[model samples]
Target: MTGRITFWFDFASTYSYLSVMRIGGLAAARGISVSWKPFLLGPVFAAQGWNTSPFNLFPAKGRYMWRDLERICAARGLSFCRPDSFPQNGLLAARLALAAAEEDRIAAFTQAVFQAQFGQGADIADERVLQGCLRVSGLAPGLVQRALDPAIKSALRAQTDEAIAMGIFGAPSFTSGAELFWGDDRLEQALDHAAAVTI
Candidate 1:
C-alpha cells in the first residue's frame, strides 16, 4: 500500500515555501515519494469572491504570517524576505513547473523558483527569473516556449481547476487516496499515514 504523496503547492504562499525546501529529506527518510503539483491560488481566491490573499484581506493574519515565516525560516537556517507583492504572479512559474514535470525536474524547478521568490526577493512573473531558474536545472530556454503551447497551457489550467474541485483552499496541500491534508505542518502526518497503510 505504498502511496505516492501529491504535494499541491502555490508559489505565493508563505507556508508553501516552508514545505518546498523541507519536505524532500523528510519524505525520503519515510519512504514517501513526493509529486510536486504546482497550482495557481488566484483562481481559488477569485472563485471565493476575493481578489487578494487572505493575509491582505485580513491585516492581522497577514502580520502574524510574516512573523511566523521569519521564525520558521530562521529555525531552518534559511533566509526570509517577504516579496513586495503579497501574492506574486505564479502562472508562469506553475506552467514552467509542469513543463519540467515532463523531465522529472519538478524538484529542481520548485527549489529554484521558491528560492527566487521567497529567498532572493526576485519576481516570479519575470521571464528573466523564470528562465534563470530553468537554466540552473539544465532545462533548455525553449522549455518555457514549449510549456506555453496551447495543449500544455490547457493542461495546466485543467490541473488548477482540478485542484479547486479537490477542496484545496490553501497551498502546500498533501493528499493520499481518500486522505487530504493541508499545510506544511501536516506533511509528517500525511507521511505517517502513507507508511502505516503499507505496513
Candidate 2:
C-alpha cells in the first residue's frame, strides 16, 4: 500500500502557513499522498475555554512565535510577512477550500491562500483577496460563490467537529491512521511514521 498522511490545518494558523507551503514538495519526494483537510480552529479553541489564538492570549509566546517563524521561513527560503491581524478571519477561506477539493484543486488553492496572507500580508477575510488567490491557483474566481453554498458551509463545520474528535487542538496536524502528530515541526516525523506504516 502507498503511504498516506491526512494534513489538518486552519487557515488562520501561522504554523499551518509553513506546512501548507512545504508539504507538497516533501510528500512528493517521499511518495506520500496528502489528504488536505481544512477545519476551523475557532470552535476547537472555544471548547478549550479560549476565545482567541493562544499566541494572542500569551504575549510572550506570540513574540517568540513571530521570531521563530521568521527564522524558519528564512531557512526554508519561503517568504514570511506577519499579518496585521494575529488571526485573520479564515471561515470563508476554509469554505472555499472545500469547494476547491471538489475539483481536485485544493492543494493549489490552499498554497495560494497561505502565500497571500503570510507572504504578502494580505487580508484573507476580503472576498477580493480570496478571488485573487483563486486566480493564482488557476481556479475560477466564481468559486467564491460556490463557497457560500449551504453544503460547503455544513461540510466545514463537520470537518471541524471531526478534527476535535480526533483530539486535534492545533493547526498543521497530521494523522497517519490512528496516530496523530501536531505542529509544523512534527511534519517530518509524521511523514516518516506514515512511510514506515504505509498508512
Candidate 3:
C-alpha cells in the first residue's frame, strides 16, 4: 500500500514555508501521496485567545524564530529574506492556491508564492505579486479574479473550520489517518508514520 498524508498549511506561516519547499521531494522519495491543504490561522489563533501570530505576541520567540529560520534556510540552500511584514495577509493567496489545486498545479503555485514572500520578501497580499507567482507557475494570472469567486471564498472558510476540528493549532501540520504531527521538524516523522501504517 502506498503512504498518504495531508499537509495543512497557512500561507503566512514562516515554518510552513520550509515545509512547502521541501515536502514535494521528500514525499516523492518515500512514495507518499500528499494533499496540500491551505487554511487560515487567524481563526485558530482567535480560538486560543491570541490576536496575532505568536511570534508577534511574544517578542523573544519572534527574534529566535527569525534567526533560526535564517540558519535553516542557509543550511538547506534555500533563499531567506524576512518580509517587511511578519505575517502578510494570505486570504487571497489561499484562495488562489485552491484554484490551482483544481488544475493540479497546487504544488508549483504554492512553492512560487512561498519563494516570492520568504525568499524575495514580497507582499503576498498584493494581487500583483500573486499574479506574478501564478505566471511563473505556468498558470494564467487571470486565476486571481477566479479566486475571488464566492465558491472559492467559502471553500477557504470551510477548510479553516476543518483544520480546527482536526485539532491543528499550527501551520506546517501533517496528518496520516488519525495521527497528527505539527511543525516542520516533525515532517519526516509524519511521513514515516504514514508509510508504516500503510496496508
Candidate 4:
C-alpha cells in the first residue's frame, strides 16, 4: 500500500530543520508522498503554561539539544549554526510557507528558510532574509509582501489550530493515517507505516 504522510513542523524547531532537509528523498524512495504543514509552536507552548520552547524553559535540555543538533548535522554533512535566539520568530516564515503552498513552492521556500536560520544563523523573521529566501526558492520576491496578507495570516492560524487539535505538541511530527510520530528520529517509522498500510 502507498500513502502520504503529513509533516507538521515549526520554523523555530531545530529538529524540524533536520527532518525538512531529509524527508523528501527518504519519502520518495518509499513511494510515500509528503505534505509539508508548517505551524506555530507559540500557542502550543502557551497552552502548556510556557512562553518559550522547552529547550529554553529547561536549561539542560537546551544545551543537549544544541550539541545533539551539531552532531546530527555533522553526521549528515549538513551545515549547522546556533542562531542567537533559541526559538526564532517563525510567524512570518510560516505565513510565507503557507502562501507558497498555493504555488507548490512550499518545499523550496521551507528549505531555504530553514537553511537561512539553522545553516547560516540568519534571522528568519527579517523581511530581507525572507525576501532572499523567496528569490532563492525561484519564487517572486513579491510573495514576501503577499505573506503579510490577512488571508495568509489567517491560514497560518487555522493550520496551527488544526495542529493543536491533532494532538501535535512539537515540531517535525509525522502522521500516517491515524498513526502519529513525533521527532526527526521517527521519520523512517512514519514512512514505513505509510508504506505498509493497505490502500
Instruction: Tell me the tens digit of each residue's lDDT in model 3 across 1-199.
Output: 7999999999999999999999999999999999999999999999999999999999999999999999999999999999999789999999999999988999999999999999999999999999899999999978988899999999999999999999999999999999999999999999999889875
User: Evaluated with lDDT, which candidate comes out highest?
Assistant: 3
Clashes (backbone N, CA, C under 3 Å), per candidate, total: 0, 0, 0, 0
Q: State, as a TM-score between 0 and 1, how close model 4 is to the true structure.
A: 0.97
Name the weakest run of 10 consecutive residues (lDDT summed) in model 3. 190-199
**lDDT value, candidate 4, whole model:** 0.92
Pitting candidate 1 against candidate 3, the one with the higher lDDT is 3
Give a tens-digit lDDT track for model 4, residues 110-139: 999999999999998898999899999989
Stretches of candidate 3 exceeding 4 Å from the true structure: none
Which of the two, 1 or 3, has more TM-score?
Answer: 3
What TM-score goes with each of the models? 0.95, 0.98, 0.98, 0.97
The lDDT for every candidate, in the order shown, is 0.87, 0.94, 0.96, 0.92
Q: For model 3, what is the error of residue 136's alpha carbon versus the real structure, in angstroms, after optimal superposition?
A: 0.7
- Cα lDDT of model 1 by residue, 2-105, tens digit: 55788999978889999999888888888878888888888898999999999999999999999989998999998887788878888888888899989999
**Model 4 alpha-carbon drift over 4 Å, by segment:** none
